[model samples]
Target: MVKSELEKLGLHFTNIDLGVIEIKETISKEQKQKLKSNLAVSGLELLDDHKSILVDKIKNVIIEMVHYSDELPKVNYSDYISEKLGYDYTYLSNLFSEVKGITIQHFIINHKIERAKELILYDELNLTEISYRLHYSSVAHLSNQFKKVTGQSPTFYKKIGKKRKSNLENL
Candidate 1:
């Protein structure tokens, strides 16, 4: 549906995954407004202003954990998410599931796996180092999750290699 809309607007998009869509050209504010209106007409929301604050809070915590923390604290993710977002865990969980169609745990895993990929690609650290950096229980656990999500072992994925890397937004 979104693809068809973009096509009708003469816009080219490279990827559409879950809640994200990637397009090459920068859209003007007027174009964005039109797109939003069109999406609303089709019963889809283009901008979720109401959820932005909560989303940002959730994303900030994840980013901080993934990028800044050397050791992840032993705390419940749901509790942490709820505390940070100032919402009940169940409510936040339900809202996230409704909007993303995937659990928060899955989303975190995907982000973590992507972070692991970046660490691997840099070649600055070994698997153990990467595991520690990403707060995986062990290298084996990290490898298992990576394989499960990507359908290839981390070593194999690195060997085949990415021609271009994904930015944070794209990831």
Candidate 2:
């Protein structure tokens, strides 16, 4: 995995997840190039270069917003993404589709579903509460989307047990 490769290269990662990694110190250009080469072997690559930095920045913002926010906001995602990345939403969308092969909205929905699963597993709140917390229009809406993505109703997902839980990194 990329983490092991980075460790072998004498880089210590503070966090390692599916699409991102954070290290204690900044790596040099040469080191970064080498890291990119190594990561490419596993179908990963550096995302911070000039041509692709906007897409990377957008992805990072979405991850942070979904994983860290207690309540999802009602603000327009395109506006938020534009402000966060300092690029027009249209441009970001085009580049993201071209590079990642998925729309930004699809990515956000994936993260939201992942968050929903986590909240459901914790058993701290009912479906209605989780729906409100995550800004879904209604519990029915949430259930529909959840089933569409995961192929099971929230109740069924819970009753089936936690063995089917997905990795947070896979969101």
Candidate 3:
């Protein structure tokens, strides 16, 4: 979608990834506006500010790590984000909190909880396996966080999934 939008505006980008775009040349205000408007039509926004771009990069990294990666990294998340973004963890934490109104740890926990929900709904892994896959210390730890974020136990979520599935089949 983004590439097509860029092409529609005759813009040349050297690279495009999850949250990064490298244009071959500096775009004029008109082109930028057109690109922004075009992307907005597709439910995307152009991040022009440095802080917003950095925050978006942070989000993309976390999302990729949690939802897409085959396995969670075996290092501290702060250290991982710091090393990946080439900034101090404190600075990243402060910036993320200021911009997102949530700490980085909170963001990670929310995403982890979301991923846990997905695993539960899939019914492919037991809670223990899901805990290990998500790098929680134990099933209890995963369950606690899951309940904290989602207001329900993993078992409850799984049961709701089953009920929903049965309802859909009956319909």
Best by TM-score: 3
Models 1 onward score TM values of: 0.60, 0.70, 0.90
RMSD of 2: 7.4
Mark the regions of model 1 whose C-alpha exceeds 4 Å error after superposition. 1-53, 67-71, 162-171
Off-target runs (Cα >4 Å) in candidate 2 are: 1-45, 162-171
* RMSD to truth, every model: 11.1, 7.4, 1.8
Clashing pairs for predicted structure model 3, backbone only: none
Tens-digit lDDT track of model 3 for 104-140: 9999999999999999999889999999989999999
The lDDT of each candidate is: 0.79, 0.84, 0.91
Kindly indicate the candidate among 1 and 3 with the higher lDDT.
3
Q: Candidates sorted by lDDT, descending order?
A: 3, 2, 1
Weakest ten-residue segment in model 3 by summed lDDT: 17-26
lDDT per residue (tens digit) for residues 28-62 in model 2: 88888888898888887778766576677788899
Error at 84, model 3, angstroms: 1.5
| TM-score for candidate 3, residues paired by index | 0.90
Candidate 2 — number of clashing residue pairs?
A: 0
